[model samples]
Target: MRRLFPVTDQTAAAETTEGAPGGGDREWSLAELAAAYAYPEPEPEPEPEPDHGPGGGGPGVWLRANMVSTLDGAAQHDGRSQPISSAADMRIFGTLRALADVVVVGAETVRQEGYRPARARAEFAAARQAAGQGPVPAIAVVSAGLGLDFSLPLFTSPLVPTLVLTGAAAPADRVAAAERAGARVVVAGDGPGVDPARAVAALATLGHRRLLTEGGPRLLGQFVAAGVLDELCLTVSPLLTAGDAQRIAGGPSVAVPRRFELASLLEEEGFLFSRYRRV
Candidate 1:
């Protein structure tokens, strides 16, 4: 495998865990990772006012998007993301899920990835409980068309009921089918497409304030466009796939460029785990 950079001793020492997949080469330790990528130091601010404003002006949920890409900026090698993933990446992926209240994703990704329900991991059990979180975070799928497979395990067998976000104009039959299949359907917009802002609001109203989005590109673009994306945890796979694969964030190009500040970078087996937060 091609590596963009060599692994450091800190990451190398923490390369494997008991029974974790890719034990021989994976580099992951949440403690070490936290120490490595703690969100950048904040600038001094005046004494903060109470954050209890009315009508969506209050302090809302924080959005963090996790995406993986090749060193050359290809989001995927095939039609799926696993083609460019590593064991270290999977560890970080699970850790992020363990820390979130909901894992937001797009419908296309759900289908393409054959996503299953987020199961409670034994390792994160005590920590999750201490943090007042449920055994597992809920899966929230963003779909404008409501054209999802209601029978999928992701909808029928989740630890928490899976959430389906759609617009008010979505097909009623499909929406009803989703609800009947043991899914929670939330309307985010009155038009055909889901309003990214409203999607965050809906999840927030449900008491899911720590939102994590595992984007399928276009979905991330929507979140970026809405200016609701608060942070991004990106993994740079050390491969060069010379193809027409997409970038991490797709869809229509943003009219204005949005910038995120680098928080930290960690590496193992040539993979660079990076954290960037909206400035």
Candidate 2:
């Protein structure tokens, strides 16, 4: 893959080899990818303000959403994102997961995508250990109804215990069912629906500061609306699927659209991977 934005001296040198067989378009190793997408180093902690509680912002807490969309603004094709993605996209996806402490995903996405446990990648084992992280990142599912199949491997066999983020008003029986399946239930909102900011804070309280969300539109919309999203890693596909499909985010429109500045952009086989930070 080739980087297209914020060109560094190293990337510039690689660009000089363009047009040769397997030159600039050569696949990147996991190490290179890791360096390209590494999270910012933790900053010094500040004194806690009076009356602050869990979910209150703190140092090292970053929430980034990873999503894919077509050139015509379709987040998914035929109720799934796989059809609209590429090999390089999957590489970046795995890289993002490897770097995160927890992956926050919406319930519908978990079901639709055949969610599985986040496996420990051998490539990142050393890095993760040095960062004081567990063998693998935890999977945190956001749900209001808690309508999930507890029999799935995602709940039954995670390397790290899975988390269910819901509100206080969720059904008691479902909460019990989740716990029975050995999943940890976290209350992140007062009402039945999850409060996006609270969910981030809840994860933060659990020591998952490097957060990544593989959103399924509505969930991403909630995070965007709550103004808690710190960064976005969006993959722009070259193909266009002109169907009535969900955008990268779905929900009530903000009175003002949020502005984001590009942090990095990479390209491979017509796919554009772009990372943006809130401006």
Candidate 3:
């Protein structure tokens, strides 16, 4: 078996020569030594937003969520996202999670993604604490009529609070069931359905200014069509899955156009992670 080594012969020779005494045969000029030892200048940090006068609360922040698909546009492989995410992609996911004050998802996504709804690492907990937030960010689920599993880890996890957003027509029994499993239910829309725009306003009133939405496409399209989403973070996997499963956005064939400006693009392990802000 061949073992992998990080260091090369050139680096080894440099280390050995640098460690030799003045009596050694090799000698270097002052400029040569400085050039070899010079360190790259550090990049400047981004500026922080200044605090505005406190009267009216801050505007609601909306983040559109969707995973980057293959060239064929498939969000998952065999009904799961794990196959599409690499180690570096997982790290980026965690970093995005840390930046949000709340994590929002559609009820279908919560069930499909096998969501645990809590921080899986101590670093995430520590980061939340440092930001004067709870040990885990709140997990918010948007549902219109489907019943959720009360026994799931999302409802039972004591590390974070759960919020269920539903329409006015939601049954009292369903709300009671969610509450029994330690979730607060918020009624947002008229009749018996959830309105994405109203839900954003409700979340803002509940002190969740920085929101991150991880979606299952229908929700993403709804937010986009409603003109509420402010930003989008997508991780494009390299693999191809040719099948009629699901795309990043699913709905009627109607055209729903929304303008967005690219914020940044990152490539890792042949995968592209792109960030965009709504215009």
lDDT of each: 0.82, 0.92, 0.69
lDDT digits (tens) for residues 92-143 of candidate 3: 6666666566888888888888888767556556545665667666888999
Clashing pairs in 1: none
Best by lDDT: 2
Off by over 4 Å in 1: 1-31, 34-60
| Residue-level lDDT tens digits of model 2 in 1-279 | 888888767667778876422227779888888888888887876766778854433667889899999999999998999999999999999999999999999999999999999988999999999989999999999999999999899999899999999999999999999999999999999999899989998999999999999998999999999999989999999988998999999999998899999999989999999999999
Top candidate by TM-score: 2
Positional deviation of residue 279's Cα in model 1 after best superposition, in angstroms:
0.9
**How does model 2 score by TM-score?**
0.94
Candidate 3 off by > 4 Å: 1-60, 64-66, 253-256
In the range 153-204, model 1's lDDT, one tens digit per residue, is 9998988999999999999899999999999999999987899999999998
Clashes of each: 0, 1, 0
lDDT preference between candidates 2 and 3, better one: 2
